[model samples]
Target: MSQATPTSQSQNVQTVTIEREMNEYGALTVHVDGQNATRHIVEYASDELKTILRQLPSGSSVPLTIEPIGTRGNAWRATSLTQ
Candidate 1:
C-alpha cells in the first residue's frame, strides 16, 4: 500500500486600513496601501474588532488583516484589527 503525502500551503495575509462600512451586510471598504479593498466582516468577528469599528468614524484609518477562507477561497475574513 502506498502512503499519501500531505502538502502544506501558506496563506497570504493582507494588511489594510479600514475606510468605511460597505453596507448593512457587515462588509467593510478598506484600502491596501491606498488601493481599495473590499473585505467582509465575518459574523464571528472578534469583540475587539467590533469595538474598534464602532468607536472609529467612517473614513478613519485602522490596520487589519484580511484573509481568504474555505476551499473555494472566494470569501474573506477580517482579523488582527488594530489602530
Candidate 2:
C-alpha cells in the first residue's frame, strides 16, 4: 500500500496583513489574516515571500494568492504576492 500526497489547492486572492511571532514551542511563526477575519499560520513560505513580508511594516495588508498546506488544511503557504 502507498500513501498519497496531499495536493495544494490555491485559494482566491485576498488582501491580508502578516505578522511574525514566537509560538508556544519558541519557534518563529508567520500568521496572516484570512477571509471572515480568520487567522492562519503559514507553515511554508518561499524566499521571495519572506523578503516581501520582511519589507512590510506592521499591519500592512497586501494582495496575495495562498494555498492550504498539510493534510488537515489548517496551515497556509503564499503562492503569489502582489505588492
Candidate 3:
C-alpha cells in the first residue's frame, strides 16, 4: 500500500465574525450589534474557535473544524481562516 498524506490527518476549518456572538443557555447566538436578525448557536467555544476567527476577515469565507472533546460530546471549534 502507498503512504497516506501527512496533512490528511488534520482538519481545516473556516468561519466569519459576522459581528460578535454569544452563548446563552448552552446556545451560541449569532447577532449583530445593530442588526435585528439573530440565529441560534450551532456549536460551543474552544481554543480552536478563537484561533481561527483571529485569522479570517470579519466577513470573508473560511473553514472551521469540529473535534471531539473527549467523551463530553463533540464540539465544533474554529481552527483556521481561509479565503
lDDT of each: 0.55, 0.55, 0.38
My TM-score estimates for the predictions, one after another, are 0.52, 0.57, 0.30
lDDT of 2 by residue, 1-83 (tens): 55444354346467776554425432223345554444454543576665655566656677777666655645656667765
* Superposed Cα deviation of residue 83, candidate 1 (Å): 6.4
Q: Could you tell me the TM-score of candidate 1?
A: 0.52
What residue pairs clash in candidate 2, if any at all?
Answer: none
What is candidate 2's local distance difference test score? 0.55
Against the correct fold, how does model 3 do in TM-score? 0.30
Tell me, by TM-score, which candidate is best.
2
State the lDDT of candidate 1 residue by residue for 5-64, as single tens digits: 322232335555556754556566566655555655553248666556656666666666
- TM-score-better candidate, 1 vs 3: 1
Off by over 4 Å in 1: 1-15, 34-36, 71-74
Worst 10 residues of 1 by lDDT: 3-12
